[model samples]
Target: MLSDMRALTHRVRLDRRMTWTALLVLAVATLVAIPFDWFGMWVNCLPDGGCQFARNGMLWYWPAASFLAYAAIAVLYVRAARARGLGTRVLPYAITGAVTSLAFPAAWVALDAYFSDHPYPEGPLPYWWFVLDRLVMPWGMIGISLLVLAWLERNPALLAFAAGYLALVLLVLPMGDGFGSPHFGIRLGMALPQLIVGVVLLLGAFGFRRAARRPR
Candidate 1:
């Protein structure tokens, strides 16, 4: 019974930690990513977007969200460690999260350097790289983070949201040609994942708290 109580206590603490994490991710996604790139082309590209086109063309907007995310993550790990009364396994998770978030953008930078002098003729292609690079890659990062968090907490609400978000991504992925379909379809598709995530976190915040407390 003592062991079980400790486990529940730890789980509850995690639920609390992740509840805030969910809110943070959503906030940055809305405030940073949305206002910066209202076109939906660059939606949810990472955990930080500075609410001002924080990605490639406009990285200057990043310091705002970056500070918040890092600070919250620091507080999250500290509180989680204290609550668990154990060594900080959460450190690894936090580091891994940061690495995963940076994976795409970092790779893009390195590859861009290598391909700068490509042999192929380099006129701007009429098509946009938004769907695959900007949309899918960042969404992929967000999805991975969500799934990992859900698995850790074993929270049904988080899992359900993650599943639904991925399904929405798949449904929208093929809407624009190069990926096929109408242009508006592409935009709407791009918009929906971010929108749905925000709505889910808002409506299901309580559900997340309740479900996470159970901590299967």
Candidate 2:
């Protein structure tokens, strides 16, 4: 007996069948967001003529990218599903993403508050502690969102992407983002990791589409 898609599951992974074109657009959106670290409003202009290390860049970048990407994907996914006479739900993921985006900021605030309540007595705070906030940092909402989406979809590519991104982030954290340096090489070097990830995403879109087509 032939059963409709609705019989398989009440709610579908609408993005599971995302098109290459759609993926490319999503990739580009993510790629576009990589630069927010460079010119975000969440900057600390230091007296040294260089930007201070403030991890708030992710707050500007990820939310903006997510909004744009999710908005596009929502419309496109629903339109495609309806065209095929299949019902779908976007609200679940929307709610999930919204919640996920706050994970980093919330944790940061909690930690910041805790530290404020109990300041370091003798020595300075660990550098690593300060290096975590933006996507380039030790922790960021974009990373959190990526992890959440990866879990939701169980998408290996997204997982791999997150791992790769983290590797770059960890590598860059110690090197600093040209905070007090007046060298272009230092700043560009810091941004290079995200650029590579963006390129990987852009190129990986086609590969992901092809891989999805293989019989399981």
Candidate 3:
């Protein structure tokens, strides 16, 4: 029994295609859960902040669109990894990206529930929840940055472009108002550093890919 378990672990570790497929499935499942509010049980409000919107509208479609976009990218990553022979390292990075991507949305639901009753206008909720929410952004950024870094290690040029894209969004977008405003400069601050890291990672990945392609 122990030997069987070991063998299974070994197989999973070595099977890059299977690992990527699992990552893709995990990403899809996380995406599906977003609209349903399954990450944490709660009601969703419309942009007008009226009665909960029906499940079929933009509330569902927008997130679904986002999911589809990420899913497509994940598929492409899997294909590229396979062609390039990336193994278990890809699995860790993929998992990190998946978990990181889900963090903010998941925390938003919980924070909403906490804040709904207490109201930010009233005093803040217990300091812990506030701290947790603050932590989520950094934690999520790190996870995603790691994934980007991993990709950069595999394909520098592609990741450099992605980093540039992230930089552009950070610089140009009117994400929010002031420091107190949720949209303020926080995301830009977090993203800019990550993009720089991503550039370095891109160089590494490009080197790795080139080395992999060279004949012995």
> lDDT tens string, model 1, 1-216?
999999987666454455545545544554455434334244332345222122342233333444446456657756765776643334544554565556566656765677677764488643445434543355455566667766665566677877776655544544322323334344444445545555554555565556556836
State the C-alpha lDDT per candidate: 0.52, 0.57, 0.43
Prediction-by-prediction clash tally: 4, 0, 3
Best lDDT goes to which candidate?
2
Q: Once superposed on the true structure, which residue ranges of model 2 sit more than 4 Å away at CA?
A: 1-16, 19-26, 41-51, 55-58, 120-186, 210-216
Candidate 3 C-alpha error for residue 144, in Å: 2.6
Give me candidate 2's TM-score against the actual structure. 0.59
Candidate number achieving the greatest TM-score relative to the actual structure? 2
Q: What tens-digit string does per-residue lDDT give for candidate 3 at 1-216?
A: 999998875454333323223233333433343334322323353466332312232224333444443455566657766775664344445445556556655665676788689946666457555445444543224334434643634545445544553443334323222333222233333334334443433454455456445553
Error of 2 at 12 (Å): 9.7
Candidate 2 or 3, higher lDDT? 2
Q: TM-score rank, highest first?
A: 2, 1, 3
Worst 10 residues of 1 by lDDT: 49-58
Candidate 1 positional error at 50, Å: 29
**Model 2 over residues 102-203: C-alpha lDDT tens digits?**
565566678778878896557875666544544433234445545555665656767786676565555453444544454444456556655665665577
